[model samples]
Target: MRTLVFLGLLAGFGFGQGPQATLPNLVPQVVSPPDFPPELAELEGLHDAGRYREVYEKALARKDAWGYVLASYAATNYARYQASDKERQDWFRRAADAAREAVKLAPGQKGTPSLNASVEAKAYFALGQALGRYVQYAGLFTQALLVNQIRSAFSKAIELAPDFPDPKIGMALWHAEGVARNICLIFGCRRDQVQVFLNAAEAQRSNSKRVILGYVDGGYANLLINDLKEAERGLTTALSLTPKTAEDYYEQERAKGLMEELKRRKGGSR
Candidate 1:
């Protein structure tokens, strides 16, 4: 997700003409998941192996809400790492479709207390993450068009599960990158929204991945905002966290590179 955010900022899009309406303040409802199912272990195994195609295939075979969410998640990552533009677009499209299916499978409306709301929230997160990546490679007009959808999906996920850190991280990237690019400034984004969401995500970092991502993404956001001190603090914290997976290690290396860049900038500034 941080990778997508950084790349998206580098591939900047054109801004719209005027101040847009503010996003609604949707209240989050507390919800909990049931006991962990055995199928998720298999999904995790496939994901860790980078067999996203197989993960998506197996997840769809489960014919359940969580299965659809897993498919979306896997497909999104697949698209993110794809080497071919056509293949990446196809996978992202599939990811969006699977995520919508997951939302449909999950019971209840937007604000209702349904048993499947948590899965629904996860589905939205996947959709937002995928769309965020898609915009990076899309045309300038397409990027402008999809920006609202990206914001809407992440905002809905946050509204559904405010305590969930991933969506907050996504939101922080949205605000930070948007501000850096001057794309969302007219939409009431002059204030520092990145730290607010990044702090929320950091507060809920319960696992190695979450802890690592919180710092990596927080540091990335700070870098965009030109807060060198905060960016250094965040990347430093990220490197200190123990990496428990390949993805975590990848982020650790990325953070290290960012730290090097920051040091060069600091030295140049002196």
Candidate 2:
């Protein structure tokens, strides 16, 4: 049953289904679903060799059909990394369209709502994440809208699946806080909100999560309430538990960066 579930997930590619589109970003290789596809080895053979784009096109090249649409939807991550900022949203929009269509192809209430909701939920989340990237890369200077969108997407994700501990939202909140701080620098808004968001991130994942920045999140979170000892404790824990491979690096780096920030602030305070 587990193997069947894994196969089911991998068969769809990444998420949705459709023609041909773009990606949101480099889909971190670490976050694969529990249930993957049987032919994953085959598809992976193509993707790992950097032929995923070619294979994707070939799979969908034959017709303007459902599978084709689905393929595009699944391949959005690839497209996101390959395209310019303006083009990334195109990929997500395409996935959203394709996912909306998947409702019809699915079985009765069971499959239909599940497929459609999952599709839409992810599309919305990806759309938000891509927009976050756009603000940073495209020189949009629109932190207000970007943060709002990100918060909305995360709220929707929780609404869809309250049990989910979405890492994307964790990362998004971090980025959103950064944007807010930078954008509000002129107006002299509260800087503490940045720490607030980061704390929420840590609280959400500290036990089961890794420090993307090495020791910074722990360093800062522990220090924020004047918990320097606890901060060091948490960060030190992260350093020991941190994975040597995969997405753990992001957390490691995050912790490292936060510690640096703390030191800088301490120096400034002195």
Candidate 3:
């Protein structure tokens, strides 16, 4: 299957597309988002050479309008480095903000409503993902807070463009937002607070590739909640739906790890 063209669709998701874009033959000049000023090929070379940290740093420098694209690239690597919450959150927040800026700047003189709408969807979704990552590591309360942000991103992502793969949406709302809020309620999240983001993520089940990534993330969230059965199911499904593109290798490694863990648990039980 042709891997979906995922990057530029959102931020903080690590759908890196360095040279893939066809700079228009006719379009207004706009500076690329602020971020690490590395060419994609150089970054790719770094990644290929196993210099992941360098690649991440390179991406982190891109903090302009299309910053999310680079930030997402950075965060994807940061997650692997066992970064501290403060460290990673700072990066994620920066990336999300940059992505949002890209959306605002995306509307050039020639931009149609359709294009603007798509840009908004990507920006919001990227912000939500970045915030969600921060919330997850902060604590139960943080998780609860992040749920609302996640839903908000997905909600906007859907409202602007509601025609993504079904599983993508499912992960965002049904799994990421829904399960987190409900679980957080047991901790301290307010009822109304939970409803806002939960409803939004739930309302759309076809937001984007996020639905699938959400499921994968949802499984990890389940682990955070200590729901082994659910974690098993979620991770299993996540592995199944996970894409195999070079961009998806990080997730693929994670899914494989989850499978191994689940199997270990099952074997232990037996």
Candidate 4:
């Protein structure tokens, strides 16, 4: 999972709001079904075993929509751990291409029921992540241009799986970082949009009973929006939750770092 590390900074703050207001305790309504195909499962196993190249190769061999999405995910991870910028760019582009292919073959586009809603949602989520990675490497002009695409892809994923927490996190980050980077360019973007998405993400995360990324993401968004109290609460919640995967552990570390930063900032203010 790509971390929105760019949003970690508190610089160039805009769109000021008052102290974070308390959000009502919302029960999460989303339930993600185990919808991965056998082939995809095999790819995941290989990926979990740190066999990225094999996962990529097997995923490519499958030559299906899900395969492409899985391949994109594997490629993205391979790129993530690499040291070279050129390699990262190449792999991210490959991941983006595969995700695009998956979208084209996704069901319910032209009223085709070939693929189920869950499958289609996964593809859109993958595409959103791929686009986000691309945005990280892109120049300011290019990043500005791709923000809408990122938001749209994640929105489609949410439309497909309202209960899924990942897309909501993605959407929240999109709003938070988009506003932070260039508020004028975002269409119909509101300063409160970040809080809205964060609330949704927290609800989804609670409802889904899955990963811990939601808390980490929400905490990071709060940090970006200068909601220190909320940031602390969110990250602390994330730390208390059990991580479900290596990715979750990675996010936990990030949350810890952010918590430390928050402490530093608070102490400085005092």
Best by lDDT: 1
How many residue pairs collide in each prediction? 0, 39, 14, 1
Tens digits of per-residue lDDT, candidate 4, 1-270, equal: 112433333223221211111223322221233225543555565554445566777887877787877787777666654326567767777888888888887774322121244667878988887777776666655665576788899999989877777777787777776566655343445558888888877665544433566787778777776788988988999889865444455567777788887998889888
**Candidate 2 deviant stretches above 4 angstroms:** 1-119, 141-144, 167-234
Compared with the true structure, what per-residue lDDT tens digits does model 3 show for residues 31-146? Answer: 22211223444554444333445555665565443344445545544543334545665655555555566556544412212123344455565565555555544444344455
- Can you rank all candidates by TM-score, best first? 1, 4, 3, 2
- Taken over the whole model, the C-alpha lDDT of each candidate is 0.67, 0.41, 0.45, 0.65
**Candidate 1 segments exceeding 4 Å error:** 1-38, 81-87, 108-117, 207-209
lDDT comparison, 1 vs 3, better candidate: 1
Give a tens-digit lDDT track for model 2, residues 1-270.
Answer: 854543332221111111132222443232223111323334433443334455455535433333333344345534443445556555555543443343333222221121223433443444444443333322223444444554565556556544334433334344334443343342222345434545554554532222443244435434544545556666666656735322344345455555675667667767
TM-score of each: 0.77, 0.45, 0.51, 0.77
Q: Please list all clashing residue pairs in model 1, or write none if there are none.
A: none
lDDT of 1: 0.67
Q: Which candidate gets the maximum TM-score versus the true structure?
A: 1
- At residue 113, candidate 3 shows an lDDT of 27
